[model samples]
Target: MKIAFVGKGGSGKTTLAALFARHMVETGRPVLAIDADINQHLAAALGAPAEEATLPPLGEHLPAIKEYLRGDNPRIASAAEMVKTTPPGRGSRLLRVVEENPVYAACVRPVGGVRLAATGAFTEADLGVACYHSKVGAVELLLNHLVDGPGEYVVVDMTAGADSFASGLFTRFDRTVLVCEPTLRSVGVYRQYASYARDYGVALSVVGNKVEDAADVDFLREHVGADLLTWVSRSAYVRRAERGTVGPLAELEPANRAVLARLAEAVDTTAQDWDRFTRYAHEFHRRNAAAWANERAGTDLTRQIDPDFVLGPSALSAPVAG
Candidate 1:
């Protein structure tokens, strides 16, 4: 299952993402954790060694990605131009999750038991004109093409706010956990995310973070109501873990552990709507291309999504066509 964690900054989305990935790994599942956030701190939160945390962002390696995925295909201009819905054509490549391929080896790193990948941080050089959407595109391409199995899990820590909606990346996940705090601003983000995601039939569940007592939980229940799945109280252990003073997060409070387990069960059991997902992906790709990419890049990239390519549950395993 593919899951994403999204919420306002400082609402502890990354913390929850890391904890969930670690929990999956400890339970003997193969997991891939992607830091799609611009802040790029999921590695540290996952307790990766300093060297592993410094692995370059996959976005920075466009040429190699194109070579590995597209081979000698003349149709693709370059990897940088590939969007979330870019399909593989006759000469293009395909990726099976955790496969022994050069692209996977260069992009993913092993940290403890879970594999980690990141969308590199934005430098000052990207000051005014550069769009973070390019970095997001790299993540989109990876998720769009990679075929995940039943037991394998992919958890992405998405960039904060509604910016991710600019692309169809939000539709790629089976479930999205909105890490909302007991505050108006946090609940406001949930409102914005839900408004956009509802159209795609995306399954959204709220994880109330930093709750102090019954009143805080009451506030969340009042605001989120039926969507609230679970809650995590503020913890000193989490703080120490953030500060690098703790080892693996093995001793989570009993309540928090139970909540995490429930979250995992919910994610694993939820049925995926591939038909809705495919329709929304195509719809957003057209919207984004016509509104921006075509005018800006002088090419109708939307032409790349092949009409004959059927995107069903089995399409994930089938070879892609451009």
Candidate 2:
């Protein structure tokens, strides 16, 4: 499904995207993980062969999300009308109107082997997308490309916070995984973003990276939602990043590995309800509770994030039409 890893800066969204991407690729899905963050860490975490990447501006002067895709999607200006005319054959009939030509197709980078590109940012309806047409529909296309596309899975490592970029894409995703550690500061961000998810109609799943206790999961649940997807605990080998090695994805870390596996299953499952999807996924929530209590929080976070980067606070704060 179209998945967005959202949370505060340095909250582990990128690394988790890498871990999840790696998990799916290994499991037999040809994955296409999008580094839409513009800060662009998903490629680094994947250790993509390209040393240099020409990424588009986080949300620049791009076309509507549907405009980039190849498929049957309607572009109705009225929400009520679009809802009445969604694509022809969906069980839920969520959309009544199809985006005659909806969603953008995956874009490839000059350097990275993977084909990925993000919207140049929706201008003040510069593309003329009205109520029925949503950036979220772009998300639906992304999610469809992941689970229902040629690619086995797609991971969208979002820009910091739960502003428009993340919020816009959240609705199309199967899960809004809260990637963070055990700091109140991070948890506080998760809380705010979760509230955004609640407001935007995006599902949420908590995955703690570099964590050190069950209390961490408890705290996230208390603040965010009940389903804690998985905790990718910290590891000393993370420092290997200095030498360009990935340690957080170590298969040896059964705790994190198991969590990843469960997350894959949860995301893969066919539960359409936001609450039901996370609800079933929560069964594995803190499955290995003590692992958190026993381990020392690790430090190497492979993903690099620059706040001033295009997808950072600037893009997040930039206003777009609702």
lDDT tens string, model 2, 155-237?
Answer: 77777775543222445565678787777888887778766667555667877777777777676667555656667677554
Candidate 1 Cα misplacement greater than 4 A, ranges: 49-51, 71-81, 88-92, 295-298, 316-322
lDDT of 2 at 87: 21
TM-score of candidate 2 against the unseen true structure: 0.58
Q: Best candidate, lDDT-wise? A: 1
CA deviation > 4 Å runs, candidate 2: 55-106, 109-115, 118-151, 165-167, 199-201, 214-218, 221-225, 247-252, 273-322
lDDT of every predicted structure (CA atoms):
0.80, 0.49
Among all windows of 10 consecutive residues in model 1, the one with the lowest summed lDDT is: 313-322
Residue 235 C-alpha lDDT in model 1: 85
Q: Write the per-residue lDDT of candidate 1 for residues 1-322, one digit (tens) a residue.
A: 8899999999999999999999998988888899999888898888876676766689877567766776444566776566556655444566665668776678788765678888898888887868878777778877665656688788999999888887888888989999999999999999999999888788999999999999999999999999999999988778888887546556888788888899999998987665665566667778878878767667888876655554444754454443
| Model 2 worst lDDT run, 10 consecutive residues | 89-98
